[model samples]
Target: MSTLLSAIRSLIFVIVLIVTVIPWALGVLLLSVFRRGDPIYWACANWLKIAIWSARWICGVRWRIQGMDNLPTAADRRAGVILLSKHQSTWETFAYPALLSHPLAYVFKRELLYVPFFGWAMARMDMIHIDRGRRAEAWTKVLTQGKRLGAQGNWVIMFPEGTRIPRGQVGEYKTGGTRLAIETGLPVVPIAATAARCWPRKSFLLRPGVVDISIGRPIRPEGREPAEMMAEVKAWIEAEMRRLDPDGYGPPPSGVAGSVEGGTASGPAQPDPLQALSQPPSRP
Candidate 1:
């Protein structure tokens, strides 16, 4: 596709987003007052679906996924997952609510709550948005809400890297997500995605390509240290990243790992790419 066409499609996506989201946000806010629980979340999710669909219909960007069977299903009622994913672009955040069978609560910077229609709509949901500056209070909020949400069957997702990194570059993985998992006794599921293949971080230029999503098996948080466990998550994610999007890492080796599980195991292992959990997804 020509750069001119790419820019045109991107513009169409942005216009559709602005036009569609305003009404959806208003509707969600009104419904939040009259209704409660999953209905509101679903209502909000519906808008996300429309936005994502518009991107595909207009921009020609596409995606693919593997190992979804590894994730817990809705039938496993009351089971909460702590998804630690790689953060590459805004695409994953928009896509996850549509992809997962369950409700997802993100640990995001509090500033997102101010994003007008989109932000106001999210404010009505049960997500935890915190002040990144106040690390102590912020984490306290995460642990408290994370445990509560986990007990209630909501998956709390946290990006260990804290922010988006350029495609192929590894960022510092924080132990916060692992700490939340350990504190709540939830399993950390590492996800590897290639969102930047289509949507670059903080850029409006949406390209056409398939973003691969690789879901690693869950890591049980019992009897583990946060940093140690996160290192394992990091390794599995980074390794799988090389598998899913090898170009970013130069070339593939003669071999690859058999499985993509980043479980919480005891003792020494290669350090986990853990957040770099900023690895987001798409499967079209």
Candidate 2:
């Protein structure tokens, strides 16, 4: 009976995504292209807001956030930043774009670009995609595209660990983000969150709870090579996540304000612009 109930709930969620979310997303995309200023962006943002609310409020799920104060505001305009974040669930993908003032350009696998309305909307939004197998080529593209987008004042969100990691194991951190920061001379802001607890990747039935997101201080790359900087940023993020989840393999990390008995968090430390450039590379 429990299994059947869960399946039924999941089916309903899928129906909503298709019958409602996709159509509305398309309408917003068309609206954004024609409208200017806050109107279009707000419409886009509002659509997402409603989606999030519906998933939680109307669908019987709950949601909360933490360390949002740490997020950069539009005034910051520290353009061309490489925002590295933990990949646990789909929440960050939707929530980040909705909450952040600057449009977020995500680097995702090329395969995801084929997914119906979501992928279509992402294409219109100018999200980046790369062939997963070609490491060096992908890095080059990242550098080129990242600089272009940054100059236009967009934030780049990269999941350094690549795919979503299971609850306990931390995958080997990749070097793309660090490289982008070094090559573009932009800052790296590590964002750690436990969204999977509320919106678990493996399941569609939304769980009612607050998800914690901690934004670490940004690190500016002065003249350091990408390799060394990648290690520094990776270590910092791993440490922060460990701190957030001492057990490293328990319930998801949670925030301070709200608790669901099980939640998790993940980020990195800050470094001065010149400091990172001066450091020697360490072996990963």
Candidate 3:
């Protein structure tokens, strides 16, 4: 698509977001006073569903996912897992809540709680929002809240890279998510998403294309070191990313295994360029 057309589509999607979030946030605030936990979480997630739908309807950004069977069934109340995902764009952040079956509690920076309407609603939800400046206190909060939320059967989703990395680039994966998983005795599921093919990081321009999301099997944290466990997660996600979007990463360096640096795959590409996920659709 042309730059002008892509920008116009993105603008329309943004307007759809602003139009929906205001009223939705207000409703969540009011509902929080009367109800707590699941009700509030689902209310916020419903708005996310609308956001994802709008992205597909307005921007022509669709997604194909796999490995649904790898996750514990929604009926398993005693089972909880920590999700460590490859962060490329805001698309995954919004799409996960709608796509997944269980409730997800994201570990995010505290500053997001101050954003106008969106942040206000997020503050009310049962999530982990930490202060980045205080590393010690922040880990303590994540441990305590992660355990509590896990006990409630809510999945804690953390971006191991800490921040969004550009497409075809790998960021330093942190051990925070693994630490929480080990501390809470929950397995960690790694995810690789190629949202940047259509929506690049730190940019609003979205081209029409399909994003592939591949969820790896959960790795149990039993007797595993946080750093070591995180490395495994990183390896799986980065390798899967290369497989899902080979054109994005080009070819890995000769000696370096799964090294994606210095490669570039930008702009919209052919629709559903890769094969569909082998598993049957668990959820629409």
- Ranking of candidates on lDDT, top first: 3, 1, 2
Expressed as tens digits, the lDDT of each residue in 1-284 for candidate 3 is: 48898899999999999999999999999999999988888888889888877888898888887777678887786578899999999999998887787889999999999999999999998899999999999999999999999988889999999999999999999999999988889988888899999999999888889999877767888888998888877766776787778899875434333321211122222122344533322332
RMSD of each: 5.3, 9.9, 5.9
Scored by CA lDDT, what does every candidate get?
A: 0.81, 0.63, 0.83
TM-score against truth, every candidate: 0.90, 0.75, 0.89
Ten-residue segment with the worst summed lDDT in candidate 3? 261-270
Compared with the true structure, the alpha-carbon lDDT of candidate 3 equals 0.83
The TM-score obtained by model 1 is 0.90
TM-score winner between candidates 1 and 2: 1
Runs in model 3 with CA error above 4 Å? 252-284
Better of 1 and 3 by lDDT: 3
